[model samples]
Target: MGTISPIKESTCCDPASAGTVYLPSGTSLILLMPRLLATTIHGAVDVLKKTFDGTYDDNCPACGETHAHGGICCGIPEIHCPSPCVCSIHWVGCPGDSFKHAIQVTNTSKTEREFTLTSVPFPHTQEAVAVTPGKQTLGTEESLQAEASFTIPETFAGSKYRTVIKVKGAYEQIIQVCLTVRPRQACGCHVEQGDIPKRVKAHHWYHHFQCVEDCFEPAKKVG
Candidate 1:
């Protein structure tokens, strides 16, 4: 018998020599596919739920209403005030009562800054709203407590008043102040007797009466 030649071993190229070899085998890919698919489906479901659930920031807290995309809450314009600024303040008091609140101001910048606080009264109303510490200087990252006070006039019973307190510095801030003057005496009816329109047209009488009755029901408890 002829002697068999020694078998030559074949040499394979190194994976690094081939440049950027993907080592995952078909079985590895199959194992990973289900995990990738499940992850994608979970992300999609989350997006859909948030879109339809009205959990976005534009929903109004006061009215439980949602506005169009990028719209402000309750359709109110966005207040371009600083984070420390108090955007709104509300108070309810009987006539001749005084109310006070504290507004916090901060110097958000790196350097010292001066600020001025001014109260702008609503047109045609003599609401006695005042902001103290009208002018102040704050150091870097320092904060100040400003006072806002209002005294309801004796003649201002059963009325609503609004005033704006403005803070001017490196930037401007606005605080809306609202005062509700409670009636001294009850109207004796569920609906406020004074608010009823005396001479409504026959066709519109029902609507007018209904509106007055529904709107004034809460006022009965104020006194």
Candidate 2:
């Protein structure tokens, strides 16, 4: 145990000393602020791993497509760890005519804390499907571990998916985890920089007409 260095003028302890000083559960409420640590600790490498060696035994082989191809269903997006690890979706081969897929997230926070996950697709979402438990009291036990999981969706109708993890610790520091998704299906119609509109203004009349007349011109820009 470490003693908090005292401050002047006030009898109360400093906010920076909160992490070291023991506090009751829920007493250590973290204010989600931009930055509290004046001395920024470079984020650790985020990592993701799956222990699904035998989770799904009957599901068919995962569709290789990145996006929905009509009848096939894909796993959800996931993220993990702040450093020393990479997060993404993974597919594993299973027994005859079966396989498993998962979104693995990992954290590299040296300090133990609570983690919450949410997404725009499920805006009203509230709850922590995954989290790392804190350590036991001093002279007791010090555990080192992190937690997260694959959040299943109700439907696969979304064009894309994204999720975020908000980590709040006794130190009052907050971190974010952003997970991005990609569709499996390839674009039937190629898009080029020229095809994209800018400034949100009306495009040239002649250019718009020419595009309808000779759409091939735009395709050239794609290549």
Candidate 3:
């Protein structure tokens, strides 16, 4: 025998608002609050996961795809100088021998530039290394063919020598040189002709001789 009150309108259902929920009188607000908070937290985590997992392209800001050179961005070091800004050269020889290699350098820039070439020896005497055309001027796209040599002294005991040739111009280029000097006697093994087995297969005989040769090989230095 009591009259029911009219249901008042609730403003919490607006889309512009946050995790606000309207509850009727006598409803369990405590139970609904956790569910609302959980939903809001789950939605926020999903958004964050998607943002972090988004795929992106490797588009360089300095030089775009149009200016890429040799599969590298033009603004980087690999193609900045003359196709390759850094390189390595290796040579194997005997002691008291001189080894020479030709190095081709080009000016890839748009203007004339002068390059000064210098060598920095590593664990070796400075007199052992030499580079020709120490200084040269090149027009745009012009190339220079230079020579680098390493002379192993007769009394040198080490089997390895290294040097770095630095070319300085608008951009610096690094050339790493490694020289391996071995004794003449270390080149081959001295297996007697009578040591071969007459009944062995050709491949097996070859393998056996290779292993024997390796056993007599001298220790080589790694650069």
Per-candidate clashes come to 0, 19, 0
Worst 10 residues of 3 by lDDT: 210-219
TM-score of each: 0.45, 0.23, 0.46
Q: Is candidate 1 or candidate 3 better by lDDT?
A: 1
Q: Rank the candidates by TM-score, best first.
A: 3, 1, 2
Q: Best by lDDT, which number?
A: 1
Candidate 3 segments exceeding 4 Å error: 1-85, 183-223
lDDT of 1 by residue, 127-173 (tens): 54788888999999898889998877777778787778888888777
Off by over 4 Å in 1: 1-85, 186-223
Alpha-carbon lDDT of model 2: 0.36
User: What is the Cα-based lDDT of residue 43 in candidate 2?
Assistant: 30
Q: Candidate 3: what lDDT?
A: 0.71
Instruction: Give each model's whole-structure lDDT.
Output: 0.76, 0.36, 0.71
Q: In candidate 2, what are the lDDT values of residues 120-169, reduced to their tens digit?
A: 22244442234344222222133334444444333322234334443333
